[model samples]
Target: MSDAVLLLAHGTPNTLGEMAEYLDKVTGGRAVPAEVVEELQHRYALIGLRETAGAEPPPLTKWTLAQGQLLGRLFFDNGLKTKVYVAMRNWHPYIADVVAQMRQDGVTRFRAICLAPQNSRTSVGLYRKATLAAAEGMEVEFVAGWAEHPLLIEAFAEKLRTVWKVACDELGKRVPVLFTAHSVPTRTVTGDAPDPYPIEAKRTAALVAECMKAAGLGEQDWRFAFQSQGVSGGPWIGPTVEETLGVLREEGHRGVVIQPVGFLCDHVEILYDIDIAFRQIADEMGLKLWRAESLNDSPLLTRALAELALGPYTAGVEVAPISARV
Candidate 1:
């Protein structure tokens, strides 16, 4: 049986024109003129890290490709005869296109893994639905969530430790650790039931904090914060990372280290939201902000994924269920 691994992600537009076009499509033909698209494209252009210069931003798509290639290498290194495929929920190289390509390539059996570690109706759940819709006739198994994977926790802890060491050496003081993840809608948290997100965020933060404490950092020095709240105000996660910074500044925090615990890579959210937006906010608030490097193409993250993929095959162990909290 020819086996393939299908990786799915939420994609981004590759150019301003494409972005504007997508926005118009999503908005049902609300006119987005070419000039508007061009101006917006410049924002991505200024980043200078797009897959193609003067093209629409392919940040998410590029990350998804990198992740798939990394996983493919891991499988190859371990002597697993598997090919990797990447599909996006939005933008070019759409899930449907990738599914068709996979079918044409003679991939008969498959495993689908959504890049998001945590499970929520909006993120992982949506990916699952989309992937299933795309598969239609393909025989495929799915890995729902790996939020509680041991190696994943270890990788995050390792990242925190690395940042803590730098902070100690540079600032001559232990920087307060702020574990952050992307904020989902408040409705997820309060509407008729508790969202699994806050629980998962707290769990991840706790694991990292536990690892830090094991490395001699104290729990009192760390906190869990949420970031990237959309304009909708039903009740996104809190205290917002930016707001936490403000409160910390008021409470006399000198230097702070931020860990984007939610994201696995340095996408626009990490680049713009935390680096550009929050960094500016910290600066204006007279607070020193240092963010840990993202888990982008990190060896530890790769190893974690490898371990997760090979667990059932090599260790004869079933992957643990997603933790209810964290």
Candidate 2:
């Protein structure tokens, strides 16, 4: 049987003109306020301006495809006859388009892995539903979460260690490290059968913290927050990064380091949200902020994804449920 690995990601608009369309897809064709679109347009423009200034913001759509190609090469090198396919949930080369291409390629079955490490019905569930709807004739295995995958944890921890010392030295103290993830609506994970997202997300942070201990961070030196919360409505999950930063400042901290444990690659969320918006808040509060780099096209990330694809993955993880994961 011909097999493929379909890598799904939350895609970004390639240009400002596509912002409204992207928002429409994200909100399931609901009307997004014009102000919201304008705000997002501004954010996208900032990223573009950063690219023009030569810092080269992470072009998310490109990064998603690059990550898949790396995974495809890794599979080839490991002697697995699995081709990798890139599908964006919100943009071009969408789930349906990619499934049609796979059909044309004569692939008989495929495994779908959402690029999201921590799962929530809010995001990952939607991706699963869409993929299943598209790939009607193919056998699909969905990896809902891989939060505690050792290599994945290692990738995040490695990122923290790279900047841990500088963040401390720059401020003349061991600043608190804020581990963060994208926030979802409160009801999505708290009502009914609670989604395991918050639990798994914490474990991912704890595991990464444990890895940082080898580099001299303390047990209490780190905490968690949710960032990039939607402005769409209702109470989203919290303590938000802003609130957490406020608490850190009140505790007499002069600085903080932010490591977004949930995201694998740089997108607007990391680029615009953490790097731009969060930094503005931190600066206003006189709390120096350091952001850990995203693991874009990291070989370790590919290894983690590969293990998830070719499982029976049952060990070397700290807090992930082995067999019960969705």
Candidate 3:
């Protein structure tokens, strides 16, 4: 059977120049001098990815492509004939256009998967609507979230273990673990709106904690934190990871390990917020800070995603395995 997988993402703007402009707008016309932008530029540059200046770049397009290729190889290795396609929202080569391209390419069976591992109405909901709108009359299955996928938990746990070992060696002491994710508006929790953001975030943290515990790390040594509050409002989930670090410093903890459970790749949040911003804060506060590597194109993550795609699909929802993968 000829099938196709549409991996949907929220892309970033293209090019250093374009990014500078976007950030300026996002930051409310603040003068984000070229130097600051250059620092931001270095983050993407480290991964050998660049955005175009004038063009609005799909932030996740490159990531989607990488993931698609991984899935393609996995399918081929498993003796399955499946073509993978990447569709983006809020950027070029949008979901609608990708659907048209897929239709033109003679794609039949279609499976739509949100690149986000967790499910929240704001995040996956928009993608679901876009996918369905693009599908029109086409038959498509959507996989919303896989918060508790055993393989995913295992991959993250392993990543944490590796980083923790390094932190121990570098700091010569047991480091505190701070698990973080982007924070959503407090309204998302208090409003009548159905936002699964908090639930999913806590779930991922809990599972990771369980895996870490099994690896001999005690729960008391780790804490769940939130970050990247791009908005100012009533409240957002916290002890903000940054704030948590400050607390740790006040408590005289000199070594800390950060694990970003909310994101799979190193994007602006990880690059700037954690790597640069938090590092500076930690340094000034007389503490050592390190982050576990993101699950960027990891074979383990890819395998977990493949398994999720093959399972039954849902809309604007999260589904996770009860146990961690070995």
| TM-score, predicted candidate 3 vs. hidden true structure | 0.84
Name model 2 segments beyond 4 Å from true.
Answer: 49-58, 313-326
The global Cα lDDT (0 to 1) of model 3 is 0.75
> How do the residues 1-326 of candidate 1 rate in per-residue lDDT, one tens digit apiece?
23887877777677544676665643346666676666556655555544344443355666667878888887776567878888877667788889889989988778777777776776777778878888888887777777766667778887778878888788787778888988888777776766576777678778778877867778678888888875534667688987788878888877788888778876767777777778889899887788888777777777666555543422223353212111
In the range 266-309, model 2's lDDT, one tens digit per residue, is 87888999999999999999988899999998878877777776
- Winner by lDDT: 2
> Which residues of candidate 3, in runs, are more than 4 Å off?
19-60, 232-234, 313-326
- The RMSD (Cα, Å) of candidate 2 is 4.1
Rank list by lDDT: 2, 3, 1
TM-score of each: 0.85, 0.92, 0.84
Q: Model 1 — TM-score against the truth?
A: 0.85
- Residue pair clashes in candidate 3: 11-58, 11-59, 11-60, 12-58, 12-59, 14-51, 14-52, 14-57, 15-51, 15-52
Candidate 2 — which pairs collide?
none
Q: For each candidate, how many residue pairs have backbone atoms clashing (under 3 Å)? A: 9, 0, 10
